[model samples]
Target: MYKQLLITGGAGFIGSNFVAHWLAQHPHTQVTILDLLTYAGNMANLQSVADNPNLSFVRGDIGDKALVSSLFAEKDFDCVVHFAAESHVDRSIEEPDIFLKTNVLGTHNLLECAKQHWLYPGAKPRTHLFHHVSTDEVFGSLQPGESPFTEENNYKPNSPYSASKAASDHLVRAYHNTYQLNTSICHCCNAFGPHQHTEKLIPKTIHAILSNKTIPVYGDGLQIRDWMYVHHTVEAIERIITKGEKGEAYNVGYNQEKTNMTLIGETCSLMDKLFADNTQLQRQFPEATKAAEGKSKELISHVEDRLGHDRRYAINANKLSAHLNFSQTGSFEENLLDTIRWFIQQHTKVSTIDI
Candidate 1:
């Protein structure tokens, strides 16, 4: 429904995917992508639509107040889909200051800028929205018998990363409540798909199996997390922006629950099957001895858990599905294989560069 849109962190995993999806779905809309190109952000993620005339890439920071305000002055953006953040839990633990700076302060910078431009005093009421893409970790770890995280759940973030996001969510809600700014917060479960950074669980596991390296599992590997396909997350964001009410938060989840061990084992099994079926795979990467021999499971390595590792994370997504009629598509097993193959293709492009 948005016309001229500003998408922060558009080169990151989910933001990049959403950019592609949005351009394809709304061909006439103009999209300006603001990214800092951090280690987790890659320019190659937008390679497919690099030539699209309607898509513009701006290398900048959300925390840069001058630049953000300048963009608002230049473009009459009807929507701001904020996806930028310092999201790695381990990295957040190591350096929480950066997380707070980017996740907390950076988000506030964008909101303040949007409020100034869209809700200016005596200005004509603009048809615009500020959609904040958040994570389910704000609800903290859920017990086995506990209900999935919903919009009504209290914020109980545990990690520095989640705490920062929790602060951002509150800010977005507060802006809506106090200043009457149109905002919607979307809390999505763990997203997995192509072009994701290798530090995440899915990509890390796939990379380990393909390279015949140790697949590290944390502390008994019983930590459960609900996985949502990246495109599904994009769809939820799109639907929320179009159909969802202002000043509301929606939890987007597929209800696909898998423990860390089970997910890794499934990846290993898929790799083994792929190698067994394709002789070229055996020849191309002879180093993948275990995966090619249907023995990738041997690479499973249990490690000590991290500080404040959540036992479980899930989202009900009933509000998203019921209100917006959002439903997940594709088979998880099939999508997992597709994701694994996409990483394999990336390896073929550059041998040493991490995907």
Candidate 2:
């Protein structure tokens, strides 16, 4: 078991969720988080596990080679669950260099540090693991009728964000094959859950509806994304750390596909339903006038499509399932309902605190 872990970006959406899950399931395990706390990285995401005796936090950048090396020298982590990256597609387009520097250079720095500390420290067998938390976008887009991406899929990343991730993926593979550095990668599909940044589609939809702001969609809104709850993705991460093979990559998926338009419509409808059924929701989110009136969809404004936007993304989880006996956590609607409630709960907290 990986009793000592270095979880980079643990203050972000998926990483933070994984940390809380890890600490709960393995109360004896010690975890140190390294995060830059960028706009998307929120300290509140770790609130649930902030007081965990086995958890620690360090504010820093992964690209800082010196800092990362110093950390490895100080601690003998059994595993490194790397989640830090510049992940926003649009933002990557606007500033591709940032993506390259973080996703590519940062990942390399972490890998070099891990290899130095683990294998050479004792010339030990590969018991130590460097688990790279990656994205399905590295496999590029799928056509309408194309098969979902598998572990064997070819590299064809479309955007700057994905290309940087692909570069990191290749670097990881090279490290494992060349140096025999113990490593694994988990490629996850689009995930949504509590504490997601508003830049993401679901959270943006919820916040837009509650704040009476315009909900913007890109182009025709026909792009499809396979969605999974963050809880399921984190479970998959745990499985990879425990049972995954070194130098291998596993694609974690929920097989829940939904078009952008469809997802937005569903979220709008859910907001309307929640407000209608519960008078408290109406009072709590008074700015959600459109949702209370069942007109939340009216707020949707379709704009120009993003440059080189991928048409669809789907993942084949057969490898992860066959190897780890893992598939999913809950039904799509069940998870979606929980996510909506979580955001609403956050909204309530903010509003109450303001009052």
Q: What are the Cα lDDT values of the candidates?
A: 0.92, 0.90
Error of 1 at 301 (Å): 0.7
* Deviation from truth (RMSD, Å), model 2: 2.0
lDDT tens per residue, model 1, 1-355: 7899999999999999999999999999999999999998999999999999999999999999999999989988989999999999999999999999999999999999999999888989878999999999999999998989889999899999999999999999999999999999999899999989999998998788778889988899999999988888898899999899999999989999999999988988888988898887777789999987789999999999999999999989888888998887789998898898889888777454332
Q: Which stretches of candidate 1 lie over 4 Å from their true place?
A: 350-355
Please report the candidate that would top lDDT against the real structure.
Answer: 1
Residue 172 local lDDT, model 2? 95
**Model 2 over residues 43-71: C-alpha lDDT tens digits?**
99999988888888999999898998888
TM-score of each candidate?
Answer: 0.98, 0.96
- Indicate which candidate wins on TM-score: 1
